[model samples]
Target: RVIPAQAALFAHVWLDPQNPPRAIMLQYYRDGWMHRAVWGDYDVIPWGAANTTERVHQGELPALGEWTRLEVPVEQLGLNTGDALTGFALTQFGGHVAWDQVSIRGTSDPANDPLRSFAAWWRSVAGKDTPGLSGELADLAKRGPQAEASVEARRRLLNHYLINVCADTQRSLAQPKAELARLQAERTALEASIPSTFVYRDLDQPRDAFVMLRGAYDKPGEGVQPAVPAVLPPLTATGANGRATRLDLARWLVAPEHPLTARVTVNRFWQQVFGTGLVKTSYDFGSQGEMPSHPELLDWLAIEFQRSGWDVKQLMRLLVTSNAFQQTSQVSPELLARDPENRWYARGPRLRLDAEQIRDNALFVSGLINLTMGGKGVKPYQPENIWEPVGFAGSNTRFYTQDHGDALYRRSIYTFIKRTAPAPFLSNFDAPNREQFCTRRERSNTPLQALQLMNDVQHVEAARELAARMLREGGDSAESRIAWAYRLLLTREPAAEELAIVQAQLTAHTNRYAADLAAAQQLIGNGESKPDATLPADTLASYTLVANMLLNLDETLTRN
Candidate 1:
C-alpha cells in the first residue's frame, strides 16, 4: 500500500570497532516478488571517506562510536509511476554496519495504492460486479496532470474516496471512532460471507491415456481408456456415464470377490500395530512379494475385517486385544533358531518406535507433552545454523527458530518437516523425505541415534524435566525413586537387577556432580522449562544422568 512517489530512505548507523567499508542497497518489490529488474540496486553508496558534498556528507567520519544519518531520494533512484510500491529494503554488505531507526517516507498517491477507494465506491454504487468500475478507475489514474481540472469530476472522485476510504473529516487526521467501529462490523460481515466449501470440476470428455514405448517420454503408443491392470480384478461401472473410471477401479479393488483386496488391507494394518506385516512386503502382494507367514490367520483376520464393513478402528482393537498379541517378547533359543524374525507370532511385538513416536514418547513420559492435536506444524528445538550449512533457504526453514513454551514440546508429528532439511534426529532415525508414498520405513542402528537420545536438545530437556519430577515426587530413597521412574516411563516396574544397576549409576553420578557444581547446574537447567529451584543442583543432575541412561535403553526406545 506504500506510495513511493518522491519517497526517501533514511537510517542511522554506527561503526566503531567495525569493518571500514559498507554499502547499502535500496531494493523494491512489485507486489511482493523481488527479481533482478526490481532490485533497484546502487541506490545509496555510503562509505568512510575524508570529504564533503551538498547531498552527501563526508568529513573524516568519527573514529569513536557515533551515529550518522544516510538518506536516498526516490527521484535519484529509478522508480516508476506504475511501480505499485510494496516496501523498502536496506541491505548492508561488507564487514559490519549496525543499523537503528530506519524509515521510508513520501506523500501519498492514490494511483499506487492497493485499496482503490474509487473502485470500491463504484462497485457499491453499481450494486454488482462490473468491468466499468475497474476500467474507469484505471482511466482516472492516467489523468495525472489533468486530475484537478474538472470540478464535477473532482467531486465524484472525492465522494467515492469518502465512502470507500476514510471520511475526509477536517477535525482529525486519524479515523473517527464511529467509522472505525463500522469498519470492524463490515470486516466481520465480509469474512462471514466468504463461503467455506470446495468444488471440483471434471472435463466433459475425459482425456485418453497412452503408454510410452520402453517408458520413453518422446515415444507414443495407441490411446487407451481408463483401466485396471489385467492381472488384478476387473473394474465395474461406477461413474455416471457407465465407462469404468479411476473411481471404479478403487471400488473394484475392495469388491468382495477380489482375492488380494481384504488380505492386503488387513496385512498393512497388522504391520502398523505388530512391527511387521503378515505378508512382509506390504507394498507388493503379487507372486513376486514374500508369502504370508501365517496364511490361515491372515485369511481369518481379512474375513473378519471385511465382515465388519471395513471398520479400521474395530479391526485394530480386535488385533491388539487378542491373546496372541499379549505374549511376552522374550524368546527361547530354540524359537529364535526356528524363526529369527518371529514371523510365526511366537512373541509379542518388540521394535524401536517410529521416528515421530520416539520424540512423542519422550515428551509423554516427561509430562512436557503438548497434547493439543492437529494444527499447523511447529518448529521445535534444532541445532543453530543447521539449515544454513546445507543451503536450505526455504521460507519456513531459512532460520530454524525453536518454538517457545508448550509449542516447543508438541508431538514430533507436528515438528516443521522441511523436505530439503528434515529434523536432524528424526532424519537420523530413518524418517522419510516424503517425496512419494511411504510404504515402509527401514530402521537403522547407528551412533547418531544413540547420541540423539542422550544429547539432543529436546531429549536432554525431557531427561532434565523427568529427573526434576523424580526428585520432587519420587520416594525419598534413591532405589525407590529409580523404581518409580522405571514404572512411569515403561508402564511396568523394573526387575531387581535393573533397579540395582540404575541405583549404582545414580550413586556414581551424584559423586560426579558433587565434584563440579557448575557442570551440574548447566545439566539441571538445559531448556525453557524452569528448573525446580527447590531441588539442589547435585540432586537433579545426578538423577538427570540416571534418566539419560534410562531413555537411551533399548526398552525405552522400543515398543514391546
Candidate 2:
C-alpha cells in the first residue's frame, strides 16, 4: 500500500536454503517522483536486512499530498524459492496522505512492470514526444466520440503531469531558507535606496503593447502606443525621455485631473467593507454598469485615501472603528422596507461566513486550529473516491488522508486548490474556481449543504471534538458546559434562555441514553467511535439525531 504522508516502515529479506544464504537487500523506488522531499534514492537500509525502518520523505517538511507511488523489489531482496516475502511496512505519518496501490513482483526487468510502464509513459509525455500522444488520440478517435474525448482528457492529464514535474524541479533548485534570508536583506537595502514618500516621476522609458486578435497570443494585431484613453484628456508627457511605467500610471490614476480612477478604487474599497459600493459596479465604473448610489461619499473616501498616502490600514481603522460599522445587523421592519439589501449602512450586514472563515471557525471552536501561515500548500482531509474522473484510466489514483497534526489545522486559504477537484466543504460554501480571477463569490443555501453539515465525516468529527473539549474545560455542571460551548463556537456567552434550552436538551439526552453510556459518550467525545448498544439503541439514535439537527441549524452556519 502507498504510505500516507511523510514516512513509513519498509523492508525485504531473501531466504536461500541451499548454500550459505546471500545477504538480504531492499531497494525503495518511487514512481514518477515529482517532489524530491517526498521520496529518497538508494539509501542503504538503516536497519539491517529484515527489519523495518522509518523511511521518511528526504526532509521533515510536509508535502502537497500529490499522488506518488513507492515500490519495494521483493525478489532483489534475496529470497530463495518458497521463502515467504513479507510486504514492506507503512506506518501513519502526519498531514493529509494518500496511498495508491501496493504490489510485490518477482521480475527483475523494470520495463515490463505496470507501475514502471505508467511512470515511463508519464515521464515520456513530460519529455515531449508529440507522436505518442497524437497516435493515442488518433486510435481513440477511430473508436468513437467518447473515446476521442477520453484521449483528449488523457492528453490533458499528461500535460498537467509535465507542468507539475517542471515546477517541482524548479522548486528543487530554488533558494532555501538561508537564501531567502539573504534575499530579504538585499530587498531591505533596495527599499532603503528608494524614498518611501510617494513622489511624482515620469516613466523612464515608453512602453508599447499589442492587442491579441481574438485574444490569442499567436495572432497579434498592430502595436498600440501607450497613452491615456480617448475619453480622458491627453496625458502631458514629461521628463527628458518620455515613458509610461507604474509611477506614471499611479500618478494618472489619482491625479486631480483624472475623473474615474480615484472614484473607482474608493468605491471598490467601500464595497469590500460595506458589501455594496456607492456605485454597484465597483470594478467597472464605465457607462454600462450601475451608477453610484452615493457619489459624494465615494469621492470623499477617494480623496481621503489619496491624502493619507494610500495607507490602507489607517483607512480601515477609521472606517471600522466607527460607530456606524459597530451597529448590530438586526433589521427593523421599517429599515427592511426602505432598504432590504441594507444599502445605506444604517446597520451592519448579516453575512454568511466565507469558505475560509467557515472552515477556520470550525477548527477554532474544536480547539484544533493552528495559527501557522505561509508555506507550500497542504491537502486537507477529503472524502474517498472524490478524485474519480481526474484520476481516470491510466492516471495515478489519489488517496486523501486526514491531517491529525499541525498541518491539518492551517487556515483554509493555504490549502491546495485543484481546478478539477476542490475541497468539498469549502466548495459547498462557494469557494472560487482558482482557474479564473474571482472578485466576488456567490452565497448559496441548499439541502446538499445541510446534508454535508449533518453527515460529512469531518464536520461530525469536529462537533464531537468540540463537545469533548467543552466537557474537559468547563466546570462539572450543565450550565457551565453550555456556556463554554457557546463561548468557543460563537465567541459569546449563551443567552439565559439559550443556556436553559441546551441544558435541558443535554439532560434529556443523558437520561434517555442511560443504558447506552458507551454510545452516548461516543456521540459527545472527539475521535471516538460511536458505540453500538442493544438496550438504548433507539435512545442513542434519538440523541445523536437531535444533536446533528442542532448542528445543521441556520444559526450555526451564519456569521451574524
Worst 10 residues of 1 by lDDT: 33-42
What's the CA error at residue 44 for candidate 2, in Å? 46
lDDT of 1 at 488: 87
Write the residue-wise lDDT of candidate 1 on 233-312 in tens digits: 67887666776766667778778878888998899889988888989999999879999888999999988988999999
TM-score of each: 0.64, 0.53
Task: Let me know the TM-score candidate 2 reaches against the reference structure.
Answer: 0.53
Residue range 198-245, candidate 2, lDDT tens digits? 775544554457898999988879897667888896676554456445
lDDT of each: 0.73, 0.57
User: Would you give me the overall lDDT of model 1?
Assistant: 0.73
lDDT of 1 at 462: 90
lDDT for 420 in candidate 1 is 72
Global fold similarity of model 1 (TM-score): 0.64
Q: After superposition, how far is residue 307 of candidate 2 from its true place, in Å?
A: 4.8
Question: Candidate 2 clashing pairs?
Answer: 14-78, 14-79
